[model samples]
Target: MQEFELINRYFKGRGISRRDVNLGIGDDCALVTVPQNSQLAVTTDTMVCGVHFFEDMSPRALGHRAIAVNLSDLAAMGAEPAWVSVALTLPHADVQWLEEFTAGMHEIAEYFNVQIIGGDTTQGPLTVTVCAKGTVPEGKAITRSGAKTGDWIYVTGPLGDAGLAVEARKQHLDIDPEWLKKLTHKLEYPTPRVAAGQVLRGYASAAIDISDGLLADLEHILEMSQVGATIQADKIPTTEAFRQSIEGEAKWPYILAYGDDYELLYTVPENHKAMLDNKLNQYGIDAVCIGQIRGGEGKIDVFDGEHKLDISAMGFEHFAEDEAC
Candidate 1:
């Protein structure tokens, strides 16, 4: 089927008036109206087979994640997702795979109220690219540049677990039934903190999603905000679920460098420290103050009390086919 006509079929099924869509489907671009007094937040992300995922990965989860990752970007900016355009590339159009993919995509879109508005399709190696749009109150979208010198840094959930899960899958590590099943799913299907992002709107000084690893990604926030911080490795949440997945010696690699954990990392000024519990209460999520931002020249200090772990400051660089261990 022709890509434009397929898109036309999608719009036809929706049954909504075209007035809501000033332009859609076929054209140089698609246009939509954002009502006055709203801020528009748009994010685009791409995932490649083998690099971002593996051949054994579920078609459904891939579709869900293809959009979920983009939505997480919107959440980092404190935006409520409203629309998404999926630009999918496929080696061949397998109807069954497409159906499962769309099902997965719509599941999260409906759950988060994001509409499948418009995008492009192409023929290539399998890659899912999504550009999601969201809305926030005018001037209220959280940015990575707002942290103050005295603010405290925070992360939404356990770190390193997803990274550990990935390594487990790569190495085909065998472990207790209960533990192996849990970690495998974490790697295959990540949960992004959409609710926590909504609640964090008013409280956070600066925020970003940890798509990259902690050290690399967090350094971005500190750089933009002109601040520094001491991140306690001990304070970073770790669980038996994570611990059981790894042997003790290789734990540091998973904790420090593996990427694809979709949790949110934010900074809060000292005044809002007391409101941490209240801030996260509505979302039923725990917000941990992992570190504090300071006035030092832009450098992130990671420590385990007194010992500092020597690690690179960046996460997985997309074009680096040769990975440094």
Candidate 2:
């Protein structure tokens, strides 16, 4: 199929309609209307075969994950997702693959009320890049710089499951079959906490999504906020499945340093705890307080019960020496 034909067949006119979008697809550049009192939040993420996922992995899941990762950014900033543009690279145009891929992409877009605006398709090694756009009320968007000393840190859901899935996929871990299925789902179809983010506006002192691992991602908040944190080892939330699948001490790497969880890690002031709890309850989100912000500049102290723990490895590094092809 021709490029335009493929686009029209699979991607054009897909996703939830938004009155704010003046033009989408078809044209050289798509146009969108941001509300008068809101700021646009834009993010882009790219997924390459082998590096990001196995080359033989499902195209449908890849489609979902490509946009989901970008949406997680908007979620962290407390923005409502609206529009997206996708660029696709493939060695050959496979109609069946494209169909399933677009189906997965549009499923999440419809769920999140995001529209596919415009994009490009071309020949190359398979890769998918999506740029997502969202909006937040003026001056109300959560950011990494807003955390203050005494604020409590919280995560929207359990961590490590997705990372565990990656390790299992690599044959690095011997995980249970049932647990592997659950972990694989977590890795492939991460739920962007859009509602929690929207609810957290004006309530969370600082916010970030755990794309890189709790330790590394939290450091972004600490550095931006010019503060440190004290996190209790036991306070970090992980699923019972994760705890049961991996034995003692071995689980810490997945929970703390392994990446790809894509859950929200945020902070709330001591005074906002009550309201924050109410919001989380209203949203039916499982969240746990993991630590408290402290006075030091960008340092994180971790403790297990009363003994301080050593934390040297942070998480996945895309540009690390070992990561190079």
Candidate 3:
């Protein structure tokens, strides 16, 4: 299919229509308005065919993930998502694949009330890049550099399910079929914590989404904030499926180092703990506290009860000499 025809058929005039978007797809430059008293939050993410996902991944899931990951970044900044521009590259367009892909993208966009703006489509190896935009009240956007000593660290939900899913697929390990199905679903359709993030704007001292594993992403916050942390290893939440499928020492890498959970990891000051808890509870968000920030230079220590555990691996990094996954 031709480029314009492909976009017109599958992407144009679809998804939520937002009043803030003055002009959308089909225009040379899409126009959008930032709300008064708010700052625009923007993020971009790209996923390549073999590097980011398996060749056999579902087109629908790919579409969902492409937009979801970018929105996750906005969520980390306590921003309300407003719009997205998708740049899709393909070796060739297949009608069925485009239908499924657009369906998935539109479904999530509509859920977040975000409009699809203009982007380019080109011929190449299969890839998708999404640039998401959002808004947060001026001076209210949470950042990684805001962490302080004596702040409490928290996560939106369980970790390592997605990592386990990837490991299971790569190693061909024996796992219960039902459990594997649930793990795979976590890997593909990750929920960006949009509402919880908005609630955390004033309450969280520092914030980040767990796209690059808990330790790796938390290190970003520590480095930016010029602090350190000590996490209770046992307190790091994990699914019953992960606990059952993986045993003993094998669990640490997936739980601490592997990525793609997409849950938010944030820190809150002691004085704001009660208010933060009440706000999250009102939103039906069951956030778990796992650690505390300390006065040090960006070091993270893990402890399983009284015993200090030695951890060498941090998280996923592209172009490293030894890339895990």
Candidate 4:
């Protein structure tokens, strides 16, 4: 059967929704409407084999990632997930692959309470693209540029675990069994700080999801918000497990430049810091104040209290063919 036909069969078999979806599968484009008093938040992310994941990567992981990255973007906007659409490209329609992939995607959708409302399937290179839709409370979408000088910078979780996980897999290090599983999970599956973003709606002056490394991503907020920042190299939260794995070695190289972390980096004003801290513990996530935004233009400083650290090696630029080769 054709890939779309198979998908059509799957969608028909499930029978999830009918109202609010005026145009679904078989149309040139799918259309849906949101009720009054809600604003739509949409984000799309694409992953290709070899580019995003290594060869022979598990379908379930790909499926989970396909949605997670997009959802992370929505979380940065403080959006509550409502519906998601997928665009999958595959060389062939393998039933086992589709089953596993959808299962993984469905797991996250259920967890976030978003339904797979519409999408398309086609034959091509093995790529997964997800466009997720979420809704924020009217008049309250978090942005990347609301930060002010003296506002406290915060990160919701540890950094660089995903990068380390990728390195571990590439090297096939004989890691301790316990640590191996955790790091592998980190690389393959990063939890989006959905709950944290939701709670930060009122307290956060600016917010961004850390798909990219912390410094690099925060630099986005700085650039957009027209400000500079000073980060204390010691203040970033590193998991005891992650720190132990590195044995007190230098961390900024990876933690500041690595992508795929999928945590939240945000700014909360000093006045709201204690309140936010109280809420952080109440919400059950570690919120680390890493730095303060300052008034200036496009400058980021890394320091150990009094001494400055050169940060020439920061941010992930896309690899060119020459670099890849």
lDDT of the candidates, in the order given: 0.75, 0.87, 0.88, 0.79
165-219 per-residue lDDT for model 3 (tens digits): 8778877889998999899999999999999999998899999999888888999
lDDT tens digits, residue span 182-217, model 4: 776877777888888888989999999887777778
- Residue-level lDDT tens digits of model 2 in 95-125: 8888898999999999998999888988777
What candidate 4 gets wrong by more than 4 Å, as runs, is 1-4, 10-31, 172-174, 305-307, 315-325
- Find the 10 residues in a row with the least total lDDT in model 1: 316-325
RMSD of each: 3.5, 2.1, 2.4, 2.9
lDDT of 1 by residue, 171-284 (tens): 567767688677666665677777888777888888999888777777888889888878877678765888876655366656656657788999887788778667686568
Scanning candidate 4 in windows of ten residues, the lowest lDDT window is: 316-325
Best by lDDT, which number?
A: 3
Decreasing TM-score order of the candidates:
3, 2, 4, 1
Kindly provide the TM-score of model 2 when superposed on the true structure, using C-alpha atoms.
0.95
Q: Which pairs of residues have clashing backbones in candidate 1? A: none
**lDDT accuracy of residue 299 in candidate 1:** 80
**Deviation from native of the Cα of residue 45 in model 2, angstroms:** 0.9
Checking candidate 2 for backbone clashes, the offending pairs are none
